[model samples]
Target: MEKITVTAQRKHRDNLPTGSVFGYLPRVVLAAMLASAAVLALIFSEVVRGWEATISAFAISWVVPGQALSLGQVAYFGLGTANPRGIDITELCSAVIIISPLLLLAALLLLMRRFKIGTVFKALAAGFLIIVLANVIRIVMIAFGWDHFGMAGFDAAHQGYGSAFALLAFAAGMIVFIRLSFGRKHKSQQ
Candidate 1:
């Protein structure tokens, strides 16, 4: 009798109520859906571009201190000097290009339900910060190139290795997101 009862108890202990294990599911799903929808809508909006340009303007100004800068808003974001010939921050050149993809990826990771919402958020915050800093650095470098190298410098910095650096930054952010979110579980499982 004792052996039979022990075996039954072990079987029950092995089975977990799925509901209890997934207590955080609702919040995760809601967050993932909201982010995915917003990301899609922002694709056709100038809000992100404007924000990116504004941020870049402030960053570049800080880097080149003392120069009078101008920002063109309403339709698109064009950051230039007082002379009017500045770099136009188009959608393609915007940080949105990289950040969007990562945002989508983070949403998908959230939907997977393997991580807690707080962990996912922390990972995303760190990753986005890295990408933003990299982008600012890229813009600052472009301004530096234009100041010292002229149009040739601008062309090289904007379309050359500068773009490559931005891509690398995105890759780094993705890695950080995955590692931070999943690493916790992987260790516990082992």
Candidate 2:
């Protein structure tokens, strides 16, 4: 009889509505989504290498004058045909790493708002392009600065302009996400 009573009590305790486990679902999903994105980005990095070659060829032909340009040349002014002062990939990678997380956070916010998946993806893609473009420009500027004032100038640009541009890109991405998400709704409501 005691065993039965204890069993019943245990069952009752077990059956008493367990707190929702789904509370963490959103966070888990967000983490998984971001992880998957990062993995895919890494996988696609190889593909980007090929694309980079093509782009480098094109940039050399159209954008910058003189002989074929190298990544180091374009990244900074010290290497290759760019100038004696090239920027290099380390600075470019640093800029990308710093800016990418902010952009990702902004994207997650838009995603959490229940925006359409397609819209979110489009916004994310646009944001990435903006960052890439801005980074390229930043590298160019750093290279030019290095050419003019040497490493000190390059370092200054990295600290000041690079940070400012990253913030601007992040803000721009968020703004674009918000605008894209709500603009349709606003028009429909009107």
Candidate 3:
């Protein structure tokens, strides 16, 4: 029985999804391309910012503690706050940047892995959801910080823990990407 299992492992080794350091090249390249595209898009496209800012403002309004009024790309928080100024949804805070890594992984996985089409798509959807949700949480954190602690809290959440939160989200998305890509169930025979 053990011999038969060993034989099976040997036969399937070539098809195993995970590999060496170079395997991550797709992830890195995709991330860079997405980041570059984000910069270019922000510079050239008002339409992009229009939708993003609206989305950001609407989302904050839905969840923020105080009443929030959204206009254009800024979300104004009210109720006698220290910094009456609202938060602006900037190019840097684009969800495209947060989700680029996972989407790129999905694109490259098409060549590197023998995943079922359904599985690949599930990963893509899940990846988008994970990163987007994380970004929303980061935004909410900033809003909450600003609402409570004024500019100091805002700075702490945005400059201090905001980055760390985003990094953790990226790490989490990568982990999910690996698991979905390498789902160790019966091969779909694709």
Candidate 4:
């Protein structure tokens, strides 16, 4: 049994010839090409399917939190009372759109080991919660804008405040990760 095991090990080592350039560049290139293709396909689909309304719906939904939050914002501000332009802003479809990118970014960072697995995951959870809270705030701001300054103000809040809120969410995630890393380091030193 020992002799047989030795023979098998020798064979395995021999099969992988030294200095044989099994390059990873080709695989990396192929992966990048595929990712680019997928992104292009998604963009094309969105463009072909009425991009304007699709984008607006996506952006609004992400910044509006859940159903109850949205309803409360609308009721409190008295903005979506009669439905503007026959469009109900009650549905929360954009949350998925906004959260998907952040989740993907977090997963990629975790997989790449940019941070510890546990730390990255916890940071991602915190980030998601922050994003939800920010979204609620954004909704309230937009509702108030619409109530006071009409469509122009609503549009401005959607574009400006929504972007700021999203950035805040991202910053929150990074801060969480950094804090966890620092805490871990400090504990190790002690």
Top lDDT model = 1
> Where does candidate 3 stray beyond 4 Å?
1-49, 62-66, 79-84, 187-190
- Residue range 21-114, candidate 4, lDDT tens digits: 3433333444355445435534453332233233333444444332221221133223344533212333341334445555555545543323
Name the top TM-score candidate.
1
TM-score of each: 0.74, 0.54, 0.65, 0.44
Residues 1-190, model 3: lDDT tens digits: 3432345656786655566658656655654664565456546545554555555566666656556665676667653544465777676775665555555566556554455445766766776677777776777778878777878998999998986997788778777866886666766332
User: What is model 3's C-alpha RMSD?
Assistant: 7.4
Cα misplacement distance, residue 102 of candidate 2 (Å): 6.7
* lDDT of residue 164 for candidate 1: 89
Give all candidates' CA lDDT scores: 0.68, 0.52, 0.66, 0.48
Error of 1 at 143 (Å): 1.2
Can you rank all candidates by TM-score, best first?
1, 3, 2, 4
Q: Give stretches of model 1 more than 4 Å off.
A: 1-25, 37-41, 65-84, 185-190
RMSD of each: 5.4, 12.0, 7.4, 10.9
Query: Model 4, poorest ten-residue lDDT window?
Result: 66-75
lDDT, candidate 2, 43-114, per-residue tens: 555444344333433443444334444552232222355454333454234334534464455446544534
